[model samples]
Target: MPTALTAPAAGAVPPDASPDVTGSDAALRRYLHGLPGVDAVGLEARAATLGTRSIKTSAKAYALDLAISMIDLTTLEGADTPGKVRSLCAKGANPDPTDRTTPRVAAICVYPDMVPVAREALAGTGIAVASVATAFPAGRAGLEVKLADTREAVAAGADEIDMVIDRGAFLAGRYLQVYEEIRAVREACARPDGSAAHLKVIFENGELATYDNIRRASWLAMLAGAHFIKTSTGKVAVNATLPNTLLMLEAVRDFRAATGRQVGVKPAGGIRTTKDALKYLVVVNETAGEDWLTPEWFRFGASSLLNDLLMQRQKLRTGSYSGPDYVTVD
Candidate 1:
């Protein structure tokens, strides 16, 4: 069994950090700009190198199961229905019904209005209900509206809130605005019992336009109390990539080293194959160490990826491909 390390409590700050770093816009800008620049070629090279690593057959089975457990089985669509969410919830709880021993997913991600349905369906399953809020895929709403969105989800029994930052503000260098918005959303995640839903700040990395910007966004979100810094909304043209996910993993690893606060990293979007999932697991283990190997500190924001993982898992078990028909259609 993997020993779980407790991440820094939500909203906890580094003991020796300077107050001025997050105190003012000028200070935040200077701090973010001062951080080391990314070496694009080197980063891509390293990610590609890590992706090529091969695990033994026994290790591959374990990796497949771990990858399945880390998925935030999701359904975010205009056409989503109650029955669809219920089906997704059932799939999340029992990924491979034939085996009866498959692990449940980390969470069931849906829109705010679908939270109640998901919560009800996932009851007693020990799986989290994660809702995408703040005008998901685009953080274009006012703070009040965003907070209301977050609070509504929490009230609806969401265990986690995946909120998008104002990419417009972030791109314009309005660092403090983005930081304050995240803090407000974090507060809004609070329930009547006082325990707050975990907040995952999505950066939508593609629009950010540069590795440096993504790194800055990662640090900024972490500074403002993000429990997880995610890459992409999976709605954009360019979503999660090996280089981008690698960058986020490096950010979380360094953040923990500096603040004793272990933040999680979620790579959402285009990852869909068993091979792709295994590559990410390698990157996480190699870049962030084994402390982040569990579902508590890492997750794959994917839907179709689950089916592929299941098929591959069955193949490993029986020495023959089960084909697409072996898994349920997503």
Candidate 2:
């Protein structure tokens, strides 16, 4: 998604009124923690007060939010990304494209190297160029090197920089160190003109896999100055689950309540169908409320998922699938 649109903001009305689904909170709470295949029990008691206003205003919503923050969602899907980019582009995939007939995502997230390609492809289009830099996918490099990569990507025209945090440092309980690293990277995102590209810190939540871990990570990331806190790299087992998502949403809410700063949340990875997409939408709706409904605050990092969403949308409007191998490339 475009950082300009979804980056965390500290100012919102924090409406004092409640949503219309006054009595649904309890029911919603029951449903959230009782989800199949995963345990929502620990979170069930915490998952309370959900509704349109609540979801729009929900500090604790029901479903998980999809962080399709990738512009090049599948530019590197298989092993041959360049080839895939060319092939998909040939198949009508917008190297940089958007439209009402097509599936428009939050941003054209791509690798730093592909930023220029995406830039040329999306030039003049409203979609922003989001690149994964700062030693993305594994953020294992040195700080200077990471900062340089960030500079290069931004200089190359990336509107957003999706950097992965040092999982080792985080897991080791070196929060201050992790916080400083993220803070430094965020600074690099700031241009000489004082404007800055948005920064999304990938928690790679699959590895953390605990509500407490997710909560702790959320707090650190937001405090470290992340525009958005992401779930995974879309390359892990526990990518985006309802339970983990609940924790993150609560983290965002608690953070807001504690700091008066409204940080954004992005549940990336493993989302591949409209049904799942809708579920994520439900999560965002119930948790963050309509306030976070826009692309800025919400995103789904998916490649196959877009096809499903487009197919479902087509089906909903016309009552028929777009057929197999259907993807809104163009």
Candidate 3:
């Protein structure tokens, strides 16, 4: 029986600080429980329909550029070193060194400790430095440790803080604990100037295992003040998929319609090729509309996908087949 904290109103200027939480555990649980259950068969069918869309050559070229810009060029490995982070930043700032026309990625995501290294590497570029916090990939730490992880990243100059929700709590039906953790992390994202670090809440939907849990987690994250609802940590067996991502898009769309606050979506892991990336764009285009097509509202959390995109771009321009040797692997 946890109590709701007073947070900033929904869609307020400062994304992090306080959340516009619904109510007590009972009320919030009741509200979430009452939301429409997902139709798995119908959802899969719709996703399949969207996946089959044929993008013209010209449109695909446009989508390739757009997809590159919307990437949260990520490196979240335990073996991640400063050299590795700098290399990733270089690639993110300029994917194709040969072509100056190539747009930079939206941001460079790294571990909290490496925020400074990434920040230094990406300095003066419009590309942002994002850090994964909340004992990332596990979300098993206590709330204080999680908040400290987030605060340290922000203090180290991370422009964005990607936090993981306590899936254990959510799965156990302790929704209030999960909700309060997001609210607290949102508060930690606040800067001294009244601005807040952008917060992206990761549900690790692979671990959640069902479309219904994914939908519920999506709403919970949005309601508790997530600036973006990310699909996975890219660490589990079942990372981002077409159906799961499509369901997330639907959640963001419905949330915006219901509350007038727009939240972004990021689909990470297993989206390795240009075709898979384009299918996601199609989902965003049709489900969330053109407004969400921009990087401000959409992102792909990937590492190898960029190299593939660069190779494809080269082929599109040179009118010849390209190989892995043509692109730099970050």
Candidate 4:
């Protein structure tokens, strides 16, 4: 069984760490650049090896259900309507209407304007409502706009906020600016009741252009009080890949070891099948241990991925494949 993490506050720095690490731009830069470099060849090889490991029938059943529960069913299109959000919410609440035994998804992710719709539709369902803020796919807006976006979502009953970091600032070596932006956005996720919404910081790793940059971005976001460090916004040409997701699993594992604070990881975009999702789950188990095997610590930010999981699940139960119509069209 998967266990919950009882750790310090999200913003709490490591007890034994130096204050200088996040004290200034130069310190943060030195710390980030000082970290060990990623071996591209070795990372790809290891991910490939893990992807080849097969699971038995019983374990496969458990994994399919787990994967279903870990999904963040999403719809972030410009033409998204309230009806669409509600339909997506219904699908998330009961992935396969024919099988009440099917697990509910972790969350329903949508644009800020659709938060109320999702929240109302998922009421009493225990499914989280996650809104993409901070200018979403492109973090190009000013800080004030970003904060307002976050506050609006929280005010409208969003349980989580997915914020995008300014990749331009990050690449320009303005590390502290990016850090402070994340910190400010984290502060804006607070609800009226004093409890804050969980913050997932998106790095858009494809724009980052290097494995080392991805590592630095992961640590930088975690240090700035991110509840989850995500790989992409799912809008980039390069979304989630096995090797990059593996690298992120390693980051969360090491971060918990260093700070005694566990942060979740979400690999968004391009993950579309039960086979692909299983590969990610295998890497999570092997890299981060069984502790992160739950929906609380790991998530798949996907839309169509749910349909495939439900189809495979039906196959496992009935010993035959279900047609595409077996699942709802998202």
Query: In the order shown, what is each candidate's alpha-carbon RMSD?
Result: 5.9, 11.0, 4.4, 5.7
- Candidate 4 stretches with Cα past 4 Å from truth are 1-21
lDDT of 4 at 178: 95
Between prediction 3 and prediction 4, the one with superior lDDT is 4
Which residue ranges in model 1 land beyond 4 Å of their true spot?
A: 1-21
Structure candidate 1, residue pairs in collision: none
lDDT digits (tens) for residues 259-289 of candidate 3: 7889999999899999999999999999999
TM-score of 4: 0.94
In model 3, the worst 10-residue window by lDDT is: 10-19
Worst 10 residues of 4 by lDDT: 1-10
lDDT of 2: 0.63
Per-residue lDDT of model 4, residues 1-330, tens digit only: 212222223334233322114656776776677667889999999999999999888799999999999999999999999999999999999999888999999999999999999989999999999999999999899999999999999999999999999999999999999989999999999877789999999999899999989988988888788999899999979999989989888888888887788999999999999999999999999999999999999999999999999999999999899879878998
lDDT of 1 by residue, 207-296 (tens): 999999998899889888999999989999999999999999988887887777899999999999999999999999999999999999
State, as a TM-score between 0 and 1, how close model 2 is to the true structure: 0.75
Displacement of the residue 38 alpha carbon in candidate 2, Å: 15
